[model samples]
Target: MDLDVAQVRAFVRTAEELHFGRAAGTLAISQQALSKRIARLEALLGTPLLLRGGTGVRLTEAGRRFLGPARRTVAAADAAVAAVSGADRPLHVDTWGHLYAPMRTLARVAGRAGELVSGHGRDLPSVAKALLNGDVDAAFGRVHPPLPAGLAHRLIRLEPVDAVLSADHPLAAEPALRPDRLSGGVLWAPGPLDRLDFLHRFAVRFGVRHTATSVNLGLGHFLAEVAREPDRFSLMPADVPLPRVPGLRSVPLTDPTPLYAWSLLWRSGDEHPGLKGLVTACAEEGGRSRWLEYDPARDWLPEPPASGPEPV
Candidate 1:
């Protein structure tokens, strides 16, 4: 039987992710397209390769047996293309958390990293999938627990977060606000609290009682919404340039500052020529700007910093 390499690739990526939505994203296709590819592959094999249920997709016995050969097939196809097209293709990089201004960090290293094609992922999960699927060479974002296997990350920056409040708010005038001091007010988040790891953990850790979510139209709109209510406030990286929203002030959180961690993520075995230079640039920049400096006694992180040197 003649196997379609694309269909085999679709199955492999879906099996790896176990989530159709993320698998489709990594392939840069719609969910419907991904499903069709998998269905066709199963039909070609004359048996169901995967079982879909409430929990997630699961591999059938046939699928378990086919996975190894399928991976080799995909790798062979990629190698053939690379050999013919040359290896000088621009490295594709992606980022997540636009609201936090991930580009601000990437911009500093882009020029030094050589030719690059940049894109954006909805979040770290999507970006991680893209890395594993070989769609992108590198990514930058907050790397937390429960990440998929076969991925690596390095802590690049530890940006201090600030509380954005309306100028009319009582605490807005304070030179610096302690985390617990804002516990009485509502925490305005750009999206659902659960999806926003940093904000959610900050609320629970610092005793923020009331929380509200809003669509993240853009930084300006989000900040404007936060400024509309005297009792509402939200967290943002201190270095992000605040749009000129009226009656909005950013107050630094003190007595244990909340440091938003930024990390570089890529597939474990990737040897993309540009990857090393990018990591080196991040390390140099981090050292020059003290981006990785953290003191547990004076700062807060949702988890302990990643261990080991920056992956080169």
Candidate 2:
């Protein structure tokens, strides 16, 4: 029997929620209807997909194995529909809010009709999902390793990350702070979850014992937290200016300063002539723009220690 999209969608939603009632609510159907859909899916597959229990439901081995492909199948179908329906629409470009200067420059060079969608204070996973699902035509953000297999990417610029500290702190008097000085300090702005391995490697390389903590706050509040706490510090791109607080200062992290490389990513095999023009514009404008001023002394930092955190 052929697989049915509706049944597959119901199964996927049920698998995600792990609750028939909630999944049905999400799908705007009654629990009974949701159960029937999942039953039909199981019948078509000729195997038990989910195990029903008192604590709700759990995906059986077969269900676990099929989850990835099911999601991809749905995404592919959605992307095809979007491509045909939006053929005449302008390109949608996503990037960090602070990086708009360079992205705007790219748009001008491309000379194509498009809009910039800023990912302000958003993490990499969400951005990647948007690209994969065709929510956006192109995007710019920090380099995420093991980029999705079907996407193409190019390095745009290398922006150095600087240390933010309370101006009155003892180390604040130094012209440049050493990486080792960060030991036992708390990082107010936690790095992305996808970079857990990288963060571990960084800590080992610098011989620093730092704890990263996340705070959900706007720029004003974030700066206030840094200014109020003597030991609390943050790492931010030197190219982007932070809210100026009376007791806060942005200083270069020395003895080894880390650089965050920004990249432009798009779906591979996408043959939109306009996209090609956009890519050309990005390279051309990126070449002439001084989005980042690289200091030779800080151009390259020491790599993480050979023996570091294991991949997650």
Best by lDDT: 1
- Evaluated against the true structure, the overall lDDT of model 2 is 0.64
What are the clashing pairs of model 1?
none
lDDT at residue 217 of model 2 (Cα atoms)? 53
**Candidate 1 similarity to native, TM-score:** 0.83
- Please write out the lDDT profile of model 1 over residues 68-115, one tens digit for every residue: 677667756765676568468787889999999999998998899888
**C-alpha lDDT of residue 275 in model 1:** 78
**Each model's TM-score, in the order given?**
0.83, 0.70
TM-score of 2: 0.70
lDDT (tens digit, per residue) of candidate 2 on 1-312: 677777887887787778888789877899999899889999888999999999879999999998767766655665566578855556676765342233444544555434344443254555665665555667776545656544677665666667778886667777787767877676655444235433455566666565655554556676677778788777666766566678998888765667666667776555443565666565666567764445656554333112321111
Model 2: runs farther than 4 Å from truth?
Answer: 25-28, 89-113, 116-157, 190-201, 210-214, 263-285, 290-312
Whole-model Cα lDDT of every candidate shown, in order: 0.87, 0.64
Q: For candidate 1, give the lDDT.
A: 0.87
| Segments of candidate 1 deviating more than 4 angstroms | 1-8, 16-49, 52-57, 61-84
